[model samples]
Target: MDVAGIARIATEMTDFSTKEAVGIAVLKKAIDINAAGALALIEVIPDNSQSAPNLPLNLGRNINTIA
Candidate 1:
């Protein structure tokens, strides 16, 4: 996750705006910060497989367009 990487993502995302895309970009930045260390940019926990409390709300759905 270097400046070049961020710029590349930005260029690709210029076509349209999406929350997911933005979130990915943010994670990329975090990973780049600690390139030499173990940077946990993302944690893929299976849905309904883990037990945790006070988790953030997930819409569990996606909107194609703003109506």
Candidate 2:
């Protein structure tokens, strides 16, 4: 079989898609953020970086270290 055919088989079995795997990979990477020191990001999310409003930061301090 040709190289393309082999790739198709591989994608269909284990990858996201046999056709749109590239797009899926891109999206997964874009949204696959770490749960450490990162807040939940939403689309069209308000950019609080421009103002010092009275918004309460929900972040916690990891004080279990022996520093």
Q: Whose TM-score is greatest here?
A: 1
- Could you give candidate 1's per-residue lDDT for residues 3-61 as a string of tens digits? 99999899878845676788899999988887735435344445542554455455445
Cα lDDT tens digits for candidate 2, 6-47: 998887777545447788777777766553225555434665
- Collision pairs in model 2: none
Cα distance off (Å), candidate 2, residue 2? 20
Give the clash total for candidate 1.
0
**Candidate whose lDDT is highest:** 1
Error of 2 at 39 (Å): 3.2
Model 2 lDDT at residue 8: 88
Q: Which ten residues in a row have the lowest lDDT in candidate 2?
A: 35-44
